[model samples]
Target: MASAPHSPLPVQLTTARPTVDGDHTGTHLGRAARRGELVRLHRGIYTDAERWSDAPPWERSTIATVAAAHRSPPPVFCRESALLLHGVSLLEPPRDVTVRTRRSPEAGVRRPAATFRRDVPPPHPLRHHEAPLPAGMSRPERRDALIRGDRGLEQTVLPPDAVPWCPGPEEGLRVEPLPLALLDTIPRMSRPAAVAALDSVARGSRLVDGPVGEEDLLAWDGFLRTKKARRRWESCWAFADADAESVGESVSRVLMDQWGLEPPQLQVRFVVDVDGGSRVRVDFHWPERGIVGEFDGLAKYQKPELLAGRRPEDVVVEEKLREDALRRLGLRVVRWVWADLRHPTRLRDMLLAVGVPFRG
Candidate 1:
C-alpha cells in the first residue's frame, strides 16, 4: 500500500527575532492580530489568519501543538496529539492537546488523577479545556501557558521508566511511539472512535510505512499498565478491522454492533460483467441477509482523487448505476451519511428498516 501524501505544516510566526517566517516584534504581532491578519495560537505565537481559518479541527489542533513546542521546554506529545502527529485517523478532533512532561505538578496546580479511561463518555465534538499552568514558571510564561490551556492544551507528567518517544513530523518535537500512543489513546476513546483509530493504525498512515500487524499490537500489551486498560484494549482490538477503508465505515460498523445488529463482512467485492468484468467493492456486506451497506462520506464527491476529475453530478450518477447493478444481483442496499452517524438512532433505524437482523 502506498503512503498517503502529507499536508505541509502551517506557517507559524513568533515574536523572537529572525523567526522561521521572519523577525517580528511584539508590537508588530499585536498590530497584525488587531488587524485580523494573524491568529494568535499561543502567547507570542501566531499564524496566518487565512490558513488558520482554512484548517480542519484536527489540523488546527496539530497547529496548536506546534505552538506549544515554542515554549522554553517542549512537552512530549501523547494520546490523540501523538496520533495526529503520526497521521493516524481520528473519529473526532481532540478535546484537548495533551502532552507528556517530566516536570512535576507545582504547588496549587491540580491535574486529573486519571486522564485516560474508557468508561467516560466521549467528549463533545467541539474542543474545550481548562488546564492550569504549572506553578513556579515566570509570570509571562505562566500566562502564556494558561491562555493556551484555556484553549485546550494539557500537560501530564511522564511516567517513570517511560518508553522514549520517536522524532515528530516537525523538528525539535517528539511523540510517543505509534504502538504506545495507540495503547494510551484507544482505551480512552469512544467505542466507535477507538475502533476507527485502531483500524487506521492497523491499515497504516502517512508516517507509518505499512500495515501494523497483530504482532505489533500484541507487543504493546505489556505496556497497558492496568487490568482495566488491558481489557479495554482487548475489547477494542477485537472489533478493529483493517479492511475498514475510511473513518465513516469504521464508525458505521461500531454502530451496527451497538444496535445489536449482526456483524457484516467489510469491503466485500462483487465481479460485475460491465466495463470488462470490473470488480466492485462495497463498504459492508451481510451475505446471510443479502444486504449491502454503504457509508456515504462527502469526500467521495469532494476529494479530487476520489472524483478522478469527473464532475460531482457524474459521480452521483455512477453511484446510482452501481447501486442498480447491485440491486440487479438481488442485494438489498442501505446507505447513510455523516448526519445519520451523528444522530445515534437514525442509522440503527435505517438498517432495521432494511431487514438487517439483530444478533442472536
Candidate 2:
C-alpha cells in the first residue's frame, strides 16, 4: 500500500470555477463525476478521481476530513480522525470522519439521525449515517453534507458533555489532544489496532526507555471520567510496547498475545560473524524456542531510504543470507507479510508449523 503523500492534493468546490481544464460549471462538474473523471468528497467538494483512487484508506480519510473542514464552524476532529492528523499509525482506516460536539443526544434518540444520498455510489460504503446526532438538529441538519461518490464520506459527531481541542498538525484544523484522542480511540479499536496506536504514541513521545511508564499511564488515566473508560484504557495499555519499531511489529505482537503464543523479545540484537561481525537486530526473538519472527512490510523493500541505493532483489538476497547466519546459530526464522495478518488462522498455522511454542 502507498504511504500518505507529504501533502494532500487541492480540493475543489463547485461554487467557484475549478482551476483545472474544461467547463467547471455545476452541471459539468456533475457530468465529470458521473464519468468518473472527478470524485465528490463532500457536498460541492471534489478531487481528481485518479488521485483519490490511488490514495490509501488513511489518506482518503484525511482528504475527506479536509473536505469537511472547508465548511464553516469547522468540526473539532477526534478519534481516528485526530490520530490521522497526529500522524499515528492505525491498523485500519476508520469507518467515518469523526468530530466532537458538546450537544447531547436527545432523550428518546437511540439511533443515528443522519440521512444518506444514494444518487451516486461511493467507492465503499461509509457508515457515517449510523452515528448518532446531537439533540436539536433538524432533519435537514442531521442529513450528511457529503455527496456519495466512488466512496462515501460522512462526518460522525461525538457528543461528549465537554469536548476539548488543540491545534492540529495542519494549520486551521482543530483536533483532540493526543492523550485524549488515544483515550477516545483505543477503546473502540481491535486489540491489534489499539496496541499499534499505543505503541506509536509511546515511540513518538519517547517519554520512557521502554513501554509507557507509570507516570505516562497515570497522566492519561486522569483523563478518564468514567470507570468504563479507565478499564478500557488499562486493557489496551497492557499490550503496548515501545520497542515495536513499526506498525507491523506492533500488530504482530498483539496477534501473538491473542493467539496465546509465548511472547517474544522485540528488537533483539546479535553480533553476527558475517560482514566483519556486524550487529543485526531481529524483529521478534523467543530465546527459549530459538525462533525469530519477522513481519515483512512492503515499505522495507519499496521505501527509498530503506533501500539505501540497493535494488529490491539485493535486499532480498541480503535477508536470505541473514536468515542463513541465524540458522547457523541454531535459530529458526519465520516470516509473515501484511496479507498474513488478515488471516489469523493462516498465521497461527504458519507459526505452529515452524514450532513456535505456545504460552505455558
Candidate 3:
C-alpha cells in the first residue's frame, strides 16, 4: 500500500539523457515532468529546472550544447559554444545557441533558440609540414577523436594559420583550442570585457593556462579581417596584465585604463612594523599619491580556503589592523567591492574624491 519511492534526481544534463526506458519509466519521468521538477533541455534530455536556473550562464550553455551534441549527426561546438567549452569568460552568455553541422544548413532547424551553420571546407586550411599539430598549437592534435569519447562530430579543417586545441583526459566536453576560442570570443565581447578575457587567459588561472603570448596574439591579429578589430584589440592586449589576482581586479584595471587614470603599482609589498614587523601586500599602490587601493572580494573572509582556518571575524579584525598600520604610514586607503565595480561612475567619483587624479 506504500507509494512507489519517488524517482531520484537525474544526473547532470551534460552527462545523461532523460528518457522513458531502461530503468527510467514513462510514468515516473512523466510525473516529474508534469510536477515541474524536470525541464526538457533538448529532445530526450531533461534536467532539474531548479538546478539549471541556479547554474551560471556559462554552465547552462555548456549543458545545452552537450545535449544538442547528442543528436543523430552531432554538431561541432563552434563560435560561442566552443568558447564556453574552453572555460573563457564572456561578457554575457548568448540566449541563441550556435552549432556547426554538415547537414546542408536546414532553415527548418533554425529557430529562435538555436542557429545551425553549414560547415564548409576552409579555402586554405593550415597545414604545417614540420609542426606536429599546427603553427600555433599549444599541444598535440588528435586526428579523429570523439568529444568526451561519447559524442561524434565531423571535424572541419581550420582556416589558414588557425590555432588548434587538444583534449584533456577528464574534461567532459570537446572544445576548440584556447587560441581559436579566443579568436571567436574577442570579436563578440565589448572592449573592456574582451581585454578581461584576454588577460584572464594570458595570466593562466587555475582553470586555464593559455599558451598564447602577446606577440603570438599580435601575429594572430594579422589574420583577422574584421574592421578596426585588430587595432582596438591590440590596445586591450597591450593593457592586459598577468599580475591581476582576480577577475574583479582585472575588470577594475580595465575601467581605470579607460578613464585614463594613472596606473597603480600592483601587488606592492610593505613591511609594517605593527604586530612585530608584519609584511602586507596591497592590491594597488600609488606611492607618489600616498594612496592604496583594495578590491575587497568577500571570498577573502567567507571562503574557507582563503580563511585558512581563521574565523571570519578574525580575518576582518586582521584587515582592520592592516589598514590602521597603512594609515599610520601616512597612506590613504580606498576600498571597493564587487557592487562598487558595477556602478563605475560612482567608483570613479569616489576615487576622484580621494585625490586619485585622472589624465585629461
Candidate 4:
C-alpha cells in the first residue's frame, strides 16, 4: 500500500557481492541500476538505491569520500574529508573532496570534485637555522627568528595510533585519527562549530545516556596537546557540555557565549505538580531568572522515532500542556525553532525580550 521508508545506513558496492563478482556485460548491473535497485556513489562506488536515496547530503558525501579513499594507491583523506570520516558535522560541506598527496599536483591540475595538497610533517623540536642579523638583536628577536625558522617542522603530525580504519566488504579505509583530525578541522571551522565537533568527539558516555566521567574529560584534555591552537582548544573545551543533547542545542549554546549572555543550565529537569506529578526536562534553563528555553526542532514532533507512538498533533498538545504547567510555577517559557537559529540575532533578541540578562 505504501512505500518503505528509506534507510540512513550506507550500502557499499562491496556489499553487492553478487553484482560485483557476477557479470561483466553490463547485463545484471545495468538492470539493477536502471531499476533503481542500485545507485552509483562514485566512478566505481555503488550502494543500495534506497539507502543512498534516504541518506542526507552529508552522509552521501561521506560515503563517496570513503569510496574515493579506497581507490588504488589510496589518497590520504585529510581536512574536511577526514572530518566526515570521523563523524564530525561541518557547518558547510566542502565543494570538492580534499586529500593529501605525496607531492603538490602540477600547477593548475584539478579534478572536477577533488582537490589535493602536499602533507606537512611535525616540526622537530630543535633545529638549526640561519637568519639575517638585525642590529642589536634582542632575545625576543632571536626567539622570533627561531619560531619562523622552525615553522615548517612545527606542523603537527597524526599519531601512529590515531588513524581510524573504516571496514567495508571490500576491505578497510584509513582516515586521520580523531585528535589530529580535529586539529586540522578546528582551524578551518568557526569557534562555535569547532566547539560542537570537540563535544561530539568527547561524547562517548553521553551517547549512552550515562554520566560524563573524568576519563572522558581527561581524554579530551590530553588530545589538545597533539595540535596547535591550544588557546582555541581550551576555549572550546571550556564551553563544551557533554550534556548538550543535539547539534542545534550545542550551536545555540555557542551563540549564547558569543553574544555574551549568561550560559543556561542544560537539560534541567523539573518536577511539576500538574497531573498529580510529572517530570519535564527543558533544553535550557536560567534558574536565577526563572526562565526556560526550548529549541523546538521539527524532528521532536515529525520523526516517528521521537514521537514515541504519538501523532504530531498529540505532541503539539502535550507540549502546550507542558508549557502551561511550567508557566503555572511562575516560570516563563520561551521557544525558538530552526528558523530562529538561522537568524541568531532574532533569537538573541527574543531571549532578551523575555528578561534573559547579559553576562556581566
Clash pairs for candidate 2: 122-150, 122-151, 123-150, 123-151
Worst 10 residues of 4 by lDDT: 119-128
Tens-digit lDDT track of model 3 for 1-360: 001111122335422434655564535655565566665555445556566555544445545555555544444555566665555544455454566432232312333211121221111111111111223332223222222343333233323111112221132344455555566557666776777666666666523434467564554453345556556666676777777766677777888887889889899999897778889999998788999999887767765667888999999999999999999999999998878877899778878888887765
Candidate 3 Cα errors over 4 Å, as ranges: 1-11, 14-31, 54-72, 91-97, 102-172, 207-209, 214-223
* RMSD of every prediction: 10.2, 9.1, 11.3, 10.6
Candidate 1 at residue 181, lDDT? 78
Cα lDDT for residue 121, model 4? 14
Q: Higher-TM-score candidate among 2 and 3?
A: 2
Cα lDDT listed for each candidate? 0.66, 0.64, 0.57, 0.59
If both were scored by lDDT, which would come out higher, candidate 2 or candidate 4? 2
Q: Lowest lDDT 10-mer window, candidate 2?
A: 160-169
Following a full C-alpha superposition, what root-mean-square deviation does model 2 have from the true structure?
A: 9.1
Query: TM-score winner among the candidates?
Result: 1
Per-residue lDDT of 1-360 in model 2, one digit per residue for the tens? 223333344433333255566755667766777777777665555666776666666666666665555444566666777776666777776657766543334212122222223433253222222222223444344444322232222233322211112112233566555666676668777777888888877787522122335664554454465677668778878768889978788878878888899999999998787786777899999898889998888876877778898999999999988888888889999999878887778888989998888899
Can you write out model 1's per-residue Cα lDDT over 1-360, one digit (the tens) per residue?
011223434355454444566655766876776676776555556666676666655556556665555544555667777777666878876656676543234222222222122322222121222222232445456556555664333323333212112112233555566777787778877888899888887677534434566676675555566678779888998888889988888888888888889999989999765566678999989899999999888777776777888999999998998888888889999998888888969889889999899999
Candidate 4's residue-wise lDDT over 1-360, tens digit each? 011122244345532233455655335545565565665444444556665555555555555566565456555555666665555545554445555433222112234211121121111111112221223555356456556664211122222222223233233445544455555457557876777666665564322122334453454344344345567766776777777766677788888888999989989999887679999999999999999999887667756787888999998998999999999989999998878888899999999999898997
Give residue 16's lDDT in candidate 1 (0 to 100).
Answer: 40
Error of 4 at 30 (Å): 8.2
lDDT score, candidate 4: 0.59
Model 1 TM: 0.75
- Assess every candidate by TM-score: 0.75, 0.72, 0.70, 0.68
Q: CA lDDT of 134 in candidate 4?
A: 28
Candidate 2: residue 281 Cα off by (Å): 1.0
lDDT accuracy of residue 29 in candidate 1: 74
